[model samples]
Target: MAEVTYYTEEGLAKLREELQYLKTEGRTKIANAIAEARDKGDLSENAEYDAAKEAQGLHEAKIAKLETVLSTARIIDESNLDTSKVLALSIVKIKNVKNGAVMTYQLVSETEADFKSGKISVKSPIAQGLLGLKVGDIATVSVPAGEMNLEILEISR
Candidate 1:
């Protein structure tokens, strides 16, 4: 079964743009590279041609994967999201119970996750633990480092 991924409108638009680019400019660039490589050598012993072919395969695979992801994606309207509890697309503020260090993150789909931007994937351990939790709820999340307790401070769309 294909997994359905939820994406914000902006994220979905970005994905569509990327898919269009891959189908056009990206494919053209790869084709040109392959053609140039093919013209440079004998078919039997051309390393450049081989490399170009491999690159083309990889590029095509990426396009196919992106297409599948786009096909199964559902755009989420942020304005309609509930802010009463942590959920996908919810911006959550959490404080470490042990150290009192507070952090904020937006739970997003894997493709839209950018740790540096404080957007975490819904599949992430922390997000998973926080999902469906309300403010003042304590969640114990298991990370590679160790398990830590976090208190939900706020939830917003």
Candidate 2:
């Protein structure tokens, strides 16, 4: 069974757009490549044809994976989320317990996570530790670098 993932409206829209592109323009481009490769020479000795077939297989696998994801995706309403504690789609402001350095992150699904844009995956160590925490609550997160303490400063939808 596929695990259901929650996505914001914008994230789901982006995913659908990508799937549509892959089904249309993406498939067309791959089909053209295969056709061109097949016209080159005998199938037995054609490396180009072999490569194109491999690429097509990979592309089809990607489409299948995306379709599965779409089938199990659930759109989350950000406006209805509780601001009292950290949760998925919550924009959380945290302060490092040791150095007092403040940072903000929006907890989102893996597909929507962009570290540079302050969006972190909900499965990440930091976000996992922050989950269910309220403002002023200190969470100890174990990261690859080591263990660190962070205090939840604010939570917003």
Candidate 3:
């Protein structure tokens, strides 16, 4: 069996919305594009038709993948989360021991990981190292660049 993927409430809601859009608006658009391309005549020489068909194929594949992900998604309730130790969905603040730089990240699932939003995947090196750690604990993460030692400054829900 495939591993179950966990998601925060907001992340799960966003996935649902994307799936709906793909089923409704996205499918309709793809159908219209195919129809318009088909109206241009000769199938053997119709570049537009080929492109449209390829696009439809890609769109359908995306929809299928999204549906599968949504079906297996498990939503986590943040209200019930305990911040006593670093864990999935915990907002952790850390300070780099070597550089004295500080950063905060919310550990989430791979699909919800976005560096721009300060969200890191639980599978990531830093998050994996930080998991199960408490405030004042040291996390030594192994990255492609090298090892980075960080001190946990805070942990919050």
What's the lDDT for candidate 2?
Answer: 0.95
Per-residue lDDT for 55-153 in model 2, tens only?
999999999999999999999987788999999999999999989899999999999999999999999999999999999999999999899999999
What's the lDDT for all of these models?
0.94, 0.95, 0.92
User: In terms of lDDT, which candidate is stronger, 1 or 2?
Assistant: 2
TM-scores of the models, in the order given: 0.97, 0.98, 0.94
User: What is the Cα-based lDDT of residue 148 in candidate 3?
Assistant: 96
Q: Which residues of candidate 1, in runs, are more than 4 Å off?
A: none
As for model 1, its CA RMSD to the true structure in angstroms is 0.8
On lDDT, the leading prediction is 2
Cα displacement (Å) at residue 107, model 2: 0.2
Candidate 3 lDDT at 130 equals 98
Q: Name the best candidate (by TM-score).
A: 2
Off by over 4 Å in 3: none
**What are the C-alpha RMSDs, in order, of all predicted structures?**
0.8, 0.7, 1.2
Instruction: Report the Cα lDDT for residue 63, model 2.
Output: 95
Question: Using TM-score as the measure, what is the rank order of every candidate, best first?
Answer: 2, 1, 3
lDDT of 3 by residue, 1-157 (tens): 6678989889998899998998899989999998998899998999999999999899999989988898898988878877889989999999999999999999999989999999999999999999999999998999999999999999998
lDDT of 2 at 82: 90
Worst 10 residues of 2 by lDDT: 75-84
Residue 38 error for model 1, in Å?
1.1
